[model samples]
Target: MTTANFVDRPATAPIGEDLRGRVAFVTGGTRGIGAAISRSLAWQGATVAAGYGSHTAHAEQFRADLAGELQGHAECSVHQGNVGLPDDCRRTINEVIEQHGRLDILINNAGINIDKIVLKMSDDDWMKVLAVNLSGAFFLTQAALKHMVERGSGRIVYVSSLAGEIGNIGQANYASSKSGLFGLTKTVAREAAFQLERAGKLTDTGLGITVNTVTPGYVATEMLASVPEKVIDKVKSSIPLRRLGRPDEIARVVHFLASDASSYITGQVWGVNGGIDM
Candidate 1:
């Protein structure tokens, strides 16, 4: 419920110093919500590695941005690749582990929104969303999981949207991918907590990772640049806050999920929509 100003000294991580020296991997972390999450993690003393799809120039710029914000410059790098591909997903994790030696947190935030009526949507439109939104997360998590299981501690969060929870006028593909995340969160948590233990492979702390998803509603970002005026008007009027969420607002919640304060929370999907759904 705290508002943000987006400059100057940042607040401490909600979990205090527990996240110090941790390593975090964030997909689609070059801009928008992803960038905000990365910046917050850096502010909390975690090393962050981000992935991008189509913005090499922005990726290059982040190296400089971190130098100013993080004080010592980020010992990080960005890879330009499609998250939908398994090879690229693996490469993203491998690169992070190779550079940082450990992977403690993973934020699956890479997604594409191709708004269209179900009748008008093409196969390409549907498949593209599934590839990056669903498949990318599956690939990256599977690749990074062995390390997590071996270490028995990790955090994973997905960036979903309000549309997925309560449908929208012209976003079937996007909605499907986001809704799928709720299932992924619960299923992954159940498997780790139950099935792994029955198989005699999980220790009390070995598989104690927390996986969650954050669903944000109508955040201001490049993706919203094309939203119809009428739709924007309708959303703002309906929202109890009477305004759209900023990227950092959503990122702050993500920072909590990646830190120890959320140690008791897992497999939960939190909506950061300014109480829009409630």
Candidate 2:
């Protein structure tokens, strides 16, 4: 019998370098896809302030891991705040700007899902999902835009879902909130472009400030841990790749949108799904 050796591989190669000297704030940055994004940005030499709603231990662990991964090449810190709250959103953005002296990227990755069929969903379930997924992004953008517009440069990326692009079973509220992000991204992009144009800082290739969204599909995250095995199998079968998306796979796309390489990309939706909806 011959012994076989196996080597673990990262989902994607690390990319991006122009992020050095930049500051990024990511909501829900402690775990799952948000954690991957935080690590990705920091690894690229950006100062990252990761905001988490709760889970102090998880956030602390993520911060430690980020520091280890960067090994003094970047700065990564964790902040506690609830994106769903207006006051918290304002305060979080203010603190990040005050601490970093500038904000270059804002990634709205915080979201919650209260999955229930429309007939069984309560008003609270519907409103809470919208409050966190949709309104939270809106409020944070409003707060961050003031600084970005003043500087005439910024990047905003919203983490949407495939459920938003297409209807999903038992995700009425989640789907609606995610869908609202599309409108928000486009409107913000248009407004920011206009501002840059007036300042004579806009180029045909890119705006002074760019806004975009990343829609991930069936990612293997803690959020999916509760999903039934049968459902997971069914979803896997539906995907062309026949596997769940890794957080890093989604993070790489986000890293691109956050970096200077994607300056020409704005108001666009980049899907990181395993060709599930295609």
Instruction: Report every candidate's CA lDDT.
Output: 0.81, 0.87
Model 2 scores worst on lDDT over the 10 consecutive residues at 1-10
Clash pairs, model 1 backbone: 152-206
Q: Which stretches of candidate 1 lie over 4 Å from their true place?
A: 1-18, 195-207, 226-231
Model 1 Cα shift for residue 7 (angstroms): 12
lDDT of each residue in 1-278, candidate 1, tens digit only? 22234322233344234467789998998887888888878777788888899868879798568657667634556767789899999987988898899999999999988889999999999999988898888888888777777676788898988988999878899899989989988888776556446656556445367889999997877666667777777878999998888887888899989887787788999999977897
- Model 2 Cα shift for residue 2 (angstroms): 25
TM-score of 1: 0.89
What are the per-residue Cα lDDT tens digits for candidate 2 across 1-278? 00011011232445346689999999998778888888788878899999999889988987887788677888888899988899999999999999989999999999999989999999999999999999999999999998998888999999999999997999999999999999999999999888888878787655379999999998887666767888888888999998888788888899889988888889999988989887
For model 1, state the Cα shift of residue 152 in Å. Answer: 1.3
What is the clash count for each candidate, in the order shown? 1, 0
Question: Relative to the unseen true structure, what is the C-alpha lDDT of residue 201 in candidate 2, on a scale of 0 to 100?
Answer: 72
Model 2 stretches with alpha carbons more than 4 Å out: 1-16, 203-207
At residue 180, candidate 1 shows an lDDT of 92
